[model samples]
Target chain A: MSIPITESITVIDTTLRDGLQIEDRVVPTALKVEIARALVDAGFRHLEIGSFVNPKKVPQMADTAELYRELGSLEDEGVTLYSLVFNAKGAQRAVDAGALQVKLVISASEGHSRSNSDSSIAQAGDRLLAAIQVLKANNVAFEVGTAVSFICPIDGPTPPQNLVSILEPLVAEGAAGVGVADTIGNANPRMVRTGTKAVQQAFPDMPITVHLHDTYNFGIANVVTTLEMGITRFDATLGGLGGCPFAPGAAGNIGSDDLIHLLHREGYSTGIDTEKLAGIRPTLTRAIGHPLSSKLSTIPAVPEPAPIGRASR
Target chain B: MSIPITESITVIDTTLRDGLQIEDRVVPTALKVEIARALVDAGFRHLEIGSFVNPKKVPQMADTAELYRELGSLEDEGVTLYSLVFNAKGAQRAVDAGALQVKLVISASEGHSRSNSDSSIAQAGDRLLAAIQVLKANNVAFEVGTAVSFICPIDGPTPPQNLVSILEPLVAEGAAGVGVADTIGNANPRMVRTGTKAVQQAFPDMPITVHLHDTYNFGIANVVTTLEMGITRFDATLGGLGGCPFAPGAAGNIGSDDLIHLLHREGYSTGIDTEKLAGIRPTLTRAIGHPLSSKLSTIPAVPEPAPIGRASR
Candidate 1:
């Protein structure tokens, strides 16, 4: 039997945040603002522009606070700009910037937590509680997401219970939603379904987001599986820009451009301007000083749409 | 509900044929024999080594007849070597070469048929009738396949009825199986599911194989869709080496190496050796004089498998 395509989907553009976080160049705050304007114009209502991490450690996002101040028009348009807050200090920066919403990040696996956050999973999560409190006190809505939620390079595969336990504090702290990040992008469809299903079952009332990478080319397959399971929100980067340290030279997030191409071709409404979306890749490539990893990055012109056989008739 | 991973699947590697046909250099017959030996050693029971088209038209496969004779030992091991025969002349070549099996190819759309085969779809079908008699007379087990079976670069999307009507003659000739090709690699999951299911429903008893390219990064997603629909036979290439003439600079077939990785990690059995499969990329790259398009071709080593959460526990 043929699976019916969902009529519409919500795509969270994380290009300026995760896409450029690990890149060598520090994109000017002006360029970041320009990209955000283009994104909003391209029909992306949700965007992750930067992380509120320590500037010394992540200079790429040092301008995130500045970006928040510069995005007056987008915020006025009721667009959601997500700033990743890793700790209480990061949360304080978002509050200082008057951020409307924040995504608190932690690792689910013990090894990733220790290496990524300089603490164990529990310690890393506990640190988020302080961040959660600051966000709540400041009246800023926040969502908590766990990295390495499915498979960790250091701690092996994460148990569903471990993920649930890790999210319990944030959920208790009144996280508006929970997000699961397949940070290294090695997850298969089965892992996605099982792991995301576990998280959804654990927090029955919370909204969930699925973050994916294309390291093993399983990203889109997992996306299809996620859609088949009725989960809507997805995080994608422009031109597939993020790189996984674990999967060196592998592709980053499934490209938002590529993902939109798939969605539209599959008869799903994403409210994205395909023409405007295609225009962003050139600007992104120039800003990054390199070609992008997404398939669309290499394709100069989009081919005419080919209707499905029976659907056309 | 989550789709159950099939216990096993049949992967038909079209590497030597489709993967190399369009390469700048014609891989020598001796080298092809060596690679074919490696593929067989790597646990591929089904392989498409070459096409029996005219030397004047596709000189890259001028050695197809020789490859058949050279693969005597592999055939003794019961590995099926499929040679593509486009018309009566090509079919005669297969018979002369004592080909154990042949894939008779016809395009489903008139535009692709005119461009690729220099004949209309109906005219191409007429040519295959003579080819079919030759194969049946020679006791050659054969399968029929249609290129541009899903979306035609020239014909837009081919109707499913177009495909069925084209295949009817071959099915009447007692063909062993049928294959549908996304020669342009532009299919989305809906297209893959709908087009494939239509073919399956039309021919209730015939075994079906899906052929795909990765022009728009939809290859693996389409693979997942086909698997979800319970169709197990897949055609892939080593290191994603095939090129789509319709969509140049896009990816070729979904990489056999990548496909095997997905299948194995998803807990599906392919009996294909990942280690041996990984080793093919280097040799394939050297032979082709360039890097391959497959994700696995970029990675230096295979990452250790991360177990699925609940499944592991």
Candidate 2:
């Protein structure tokens, strides 16, 4: 029996944040703002522009404050710009930059937490408490996202309960939403469904986004699985750029252009234009100084939607 | 609510026929046999060794007869060797070469038939009538597979009724099983599900297999969808090699190594040893004179089975 899919989904393009975090080339701030502008023009209402992390540790994201200063006016145009904040310092940085929305990220696994944040999961949660307080004090909206929420490279699989337990604090503290991530791109569809279901069961009313990577080519499939589960939010990157420096064998996030193509072809309305996103590939490729890894970027043309067959009819 | 998956699936390795068909280099006959033997050793009971096409048109398959002769003894080991035959002459070649099981292929769409077989679908059917007769006369087991059953490069999407109409004659003639293929690799899961559902309704008793390419990275996802429909048979190529030369933008078939990994991870027993398959990648890479296209071929490690989460527990 064919299951009915959810009617609509919200996609958050994370090209400027997660996508450029580990690049060898440091993209100019103007280029980052330009890509963000083009993404907004192409119908992306939610975007993760950058992270408020130490500039010396991650030079590519050093211009996050400047980017906010340049494009902060787009908030009036119904765009929601999100930046990653791990500690109170990062939260203060977001407030100083006039960020309206911030994502508080903590690793769900101990190994990833240690390497990614230099602390254990509990310690990372403790660190986030300060950021959560700052966001509350400044009246800035925030969502809590747990990285490596499905499979951790250093640790094996993050248990679904572990994801639930890790988000309990943030959910209790009035989180605007919750997101689960397959940080290393090693998760399968079953894992995604299992983990996201746990989070959904725990926070029934909170919006849940599933962050996926294309390392194993299961990104879109996981999206399909999660969509079937009625989870509506997804985070993707342009041209499938970016991998975690700390997560071994991690690949790029699922490409936004490719993801939207799959969504539209499946009869879901994304309100996003595939041709316009595809048109941005050369610019993305030029900025990255390498060809994109997305199927749409490498292929000659985006396949036209075929006629629906008898069974669907 | 999570649905229970089918207990297992049958994976037919088609590396020799579909994997090496479009490569720039002509792999040696010995290497071809070696790969076939390795596939069987890796627990593949069904293998498509080669096609009985003209030497000038497809030089890579010129050694089909020789390969069958070399590996024919494996039948005693319970391994079935399949070769593609399009006409009466190819059927005779299969019999002469000692092929106990053969696959009779016809393109479901008009454009593919004209370019691939130099005939219309009707003419190709008329041509296959002789091959089917020959197979029946010889008492050789045969299965009919429709190429481009989902989407055709030239004709666009082949409708479900078109697939059913093309396979009607063969199904009526006592074909052992039927297979629907995404020849150009541009098919999404909805197309696969829609097309396969129509075929299933038309011939409920005929066993069905799905042949997919990873051009758009939907291969495994389509596999997941088809499996949910209780269709257990699949065709894959080792190292994800091969494409349809007549179909523009067609990529390699779903990688056998990757397919087995996904199946096992999703709790479906394919009886395939992924480690053994991974070990054979180097030899395949050397034979093709290029790196393989499968994700597992390039990835450093096969992700280990992680602890099952709360829902399953």
Top candidate, metric DockQ: 1
Misplaced by over 4 Å in model 1 are A1-6, A244-250, A306-313, B1-6, B246-250, B306-313
Models 1 onward score TM values of: 0.95, 0.95
TM-score, first chain, each model? 0.94, 0.96
Candidate 1 residue B32 Cα shift, in angstroms, is: 0.7
lDDT of 1: 0.83
Proportion of native contacts kept per candidate:
0.57, 0.44
Tens digits of per-residue lDDT for model 2, B211-289: 9998887888898889879989999998888899998888899988778878877878988888888889999988988
lDDT of 1 by residue, B164-270 (tens): 88898778889999999898887677766777888898888999989999888888889888887778899999988897544444458889988988887777899
The clash count for each model shown is 0, 0
Question: Worst ten-residue run, lDDT, model 2 chain B?
Answer: B304-313
Position B216, candidate 2: lDDT: 82
Worst 10 residues of 1 chain A by lDDT: A304-313
Candidate 2 lDDT, tens digit per residue, A72-104? 999998999999999999999999999998999
Question: RMSD for each model, in Å, please?
Answer: 2.6, 3.0
